[model samples]
Target: MQYSQLGRTGATVSRLVLGTMNFGPHTAEDDAFAIMDRALEQGVTFFDTANVYGGKEHRGWTEEIVGRWLARSGRREEIVLATKVFGEMGPGRNDRGLSALNIRRAVDASLRRLQTDHIDLYQMHHVDRSAPWDEIWQAMEVLVAQGKISYVGSSNFAGWHIAQASEAARARHGLGLVSEQSLYNLLSRHVELEVLPAAEHYGLGVIPWSPLAGGKLGGRSEKGVRRQNANTRFDSEGLNDQLGKWEEFCSERDLTPGQAALAWLLHRPGVLGPIIGPRTMEQLDSAIDAVDISLSDEDLAALDEIFPGPGGPAPEAYAW
Candidate 1:
C-alpha cells in the first residue's frame, strides 16, 4: 500500500485505513481478526474505531474485540490506531462530549478497552458546539503531556469548526488537529464546499468515511431495491440515473463499481485515504485492490461529469 504523511506530522501512515465499526455487530470475532490480519498483510497500517461503535446493545464491543486481537497478534506497534470520543457510553450525564472531565475519563476507558496505553490518534467524533475551544485544547494538551494520545483529530466537523479548533491549538502552541474525517464519496461531495479547503489550509489530512456511499457506489444495492427505505436518498429518479451511469462507467473500464469509486477518491487532493470498513475478508481484499487501479485524466473527467462536486470550494462554488 502507498504511504502518506499524517497531516504535517513526521509520522507516515498507510493510504488505506481499516475501519472496525462492524467488528462486533456485523462481523464475528474470528472474522474480524481475519480481516485485520489481511489488512496488516496488505500493508494497511491504519485502523480506525470509536468508543461507541458496537451499537446500542453492546457499546465498546468493537474495541474489546480489537483489544483481544492486539493481545494475541502482538501487532499493536505495527498499526496506527485511531478511535473517537463524544458518543454516549452510559446512562450518566458525564458519559459523553468533549468536556475536559469527559475526555479524561473517556481516554482511560478507551485505553482499557483497546488494551493499549496510548491512542495513536484520538479523534472527537463530532464537534461539541457548547464546549469552548480553550477547554477542548486544554484537555488535549493534558493528554499529549501524559502521552495518552500522540495526535488529535476531528470527525464530521464543518469547515469553520476546523478553522476555529486549529486556531485555538495554535494559540496554545499545541499541535493542532492532524486530520478531518468526513463523509466524502462520489455520490456525496459536500465536503468540497469548505471542509476540504479548510483542512488543506490547516494542514489536516482529509480521511473520508463511507467512501462507497452506503454500498450505492459499490453496485451492491439493486435498482429500486430500497424504494421504501427512508434512510436512503436513492429513492429519486435523478439519483437512479446517476447510479446507472456510474455503474456503466465502471464496467466499461473493467473495474468493479467499488474499485472505481475508491480509485476516484484516492486521486483527489488533500485526501490522505478513504476508510474501508469491511465485514468480510473478501471485502477487505477487494478494497485493497483499489490501490492499484489507476485513473486517467479522461476517466476522472468522465467521473466528474457523472458526479460533480460543489464546483470547487466555498464562494467559487456559489458566487464569483
Candidate 2:
C-alpha cells in the first residue's frame, strides 16, 4: 500500500492498519502468523492491537500471538506498531484507567507481550472522564522521554475531549496527540460532525475502525451467507433497499461493496486509513483491494445518497 505520515508527525505508516484483535481468539496462531506475513509482504506495515484484546478470559492473547510473529518473523522494525490502554486488565483497582501508575504498568506489559522495546504509537483506548488531562499527559511525557513510545493517540474520543487533551499537552509543551481513532464508515459518519474537524484542527490523522459497518458492506451477507456482524444493521427498514442499491452501484463500477466502503473513507479529508481486522488470509487479501479502487466524484455522490453522513461539520450540519 499507500503510505502517509501518521498525522503531522515525521513518522510514516501504511494506509491500511493490520488489526490483530482476532488473533488467538477467532484465528489460530498459525493462521494469525500467516496473515501477518502476508500483510507485511503486501506492504501493510502498520499493526494495531490492544492490551485488553482476546476477551476477558485471555486479555493479552492477541498481543502474545503478535509477539511470537515478531520474534519469528524478525520484522518488528518494519512495522509501525500501535496498542491501546485504559481497559480493565485485572481485578485490581489499579489495573486500568489512564492513571500514572496504570499507564506506566500497562506500557511495560504491552511491550513485553508485543516483544518490542518501543511502541511506535501508544493510544488511550477511551477518554477517562475522571482523570485529569495533565496527569495523563505527564504519564505520556514520561514514556516519550524514556523512548518507550514515539507518539501518543486517542480512540473513541469526542472533539471536545481531543481539544481538552491537546490544550493540556500544549501547556506542558508536549507533542500532544498525533492521531485519533473513531468508529467511522460510509454508513457511520458521526465523526464528520465534530471528531474529524477537531482532528484536522489539531493536526491529528483520523483512523476509522469498523470501516465496513460491521461487515454490512462486505457483500457476502447480501449473497445469502449471513455474517454474524452483518445481520443487526440489516434488520432495520430501508437498509436492504439501500444495500441493494449500493451493491448494484458497486457492480456497475466493478467494485465490491467492501472496496467501495473503504474507498469512501480513503477519500475523506481527515482519514489516514481504515483499520482492517481480518480473521482469515482471504479477508486480508480482499481488504487490500480497496487501496487500488479509484472512486470518482460521481461514485462518492452515489455513496453519499445511499449512506448519508452527519451533514458537513458541527453547526453547519445542525444549524446556520
Candidate 3:
C-alpha cells in the first residue's frame, strides 16, 4: 500500500484507511473481522470508527466489535486506530458536544469500548459552535497529557473552524489538529471551495470519507440506482448523467468505476488518504486494489471534464 505523512507529523500512514461504520450494523462480527483481516493482510493499517456508529439501538456497538477484533487478532500495535466524538452517546443533555465534561466522560467511555489504552487519532466528529476553542483545546490538552490520545483531528468542519481551532491550539503550544476528514469525492467536491484549502494551509492531512459518493462510484450502477432512497445523492438526473460519463471513461481505460474514483482521490492535493468503508470482504479487496491504479495527467483531465470540482478553490473559483 502507498504511504503518506499524517499531515505535518512524522508518522506515516497507509493511503487507504479502513472505516468501520458498518460494523455490527450492516455487517456481522464475523464479516467485519474478515474484512479487517483482509485489509491488514493488504497492508492497510489505518482504521477509522465513530462512537455513534453501529445503529441506534447499539450506539457503541461498532467500537465493541473492533475492540474484540483487536483483542483476538492482537493487531492493536500494528493499527493506527481513530474514532470520533461529539455524537450523542446517551439521552442526557451532556451526552454530546465538545464540552469539557462531555469530552472527559466520552474519551473514557470510548477507550473502554475500544479495549485499547490509547487512541491514535481522536477526532471531533462535528464542530460544536457552543464550545469555545479554549475549552476544547484545554480538554484536548488533558487527553494528550494523560496519553489517552496521540493526535487531534476534525471532521465535517468548515474552513474557518479549522483555522480557528488551529490558532487556538497554537496559542496553547499544542500540536493542534493533524488531520481533517471531510466528505469529498469525484461527484461531491464542495470541500474544494474552502475546507481543502484551509486544511492545506494549516498543514493538516485531508482524509476523505464517502470517497465513492456512497457507492455510486463503486462499479455497480444498478445497485447504486436501487439503493437511491430519498436521502441519497443518486436520485438526481444530473448525477446520473455524470455517472454515465464516469462509467464510460472507466470502461475505456479497462478500470472499475470504484478503482478510477479512488485513483482520482489518491492524486488530489492535500489528501493523505480516502477512508473506504466496506461491508464485505470482496468490497474491501476491490478497494485495496485501487492503490495500484494510477491516473495520468490525461486521465485526470478526462475525470475533471466528467465531474468538475469547485473550479479550483474559493475566490479564484468564483470572482478572481
lDDT of 2 by residue, 112-224 (tens): 99888999999999999888998999999999999999999999999999999999999998899999999998777888989999999999999999988888777765468
- Point out where model 3 deviates above 4 Å: 221-230
Q: What's the TM-score of each model vs. the native?
A: 0.97, 0.97, 0.97
Clashes of each: 0, 0, 0
Clash pairs (backbone) in predicted model 3? none
Q: Between prediction 1 and prediction 3, which has the larger lDDT?
A: 1
Stretch of 10 with least lDDT, candidate 2: 226-235
In model 1, the Cα lDDT at residue 183 comes to: 93
What TM value does model 1 have?
0.97
Backbone clashes in candidate 2 total 0
Error of 3 at 146 (Å): 0.5
Question: What lDDT score belongs to each candidate, Candidate 1 first?
Answer: 0.93, 0.91, 0.91
RMSD of each: 1.6, 1.4, 1.4
TM-score, candidate number 2: 0.97
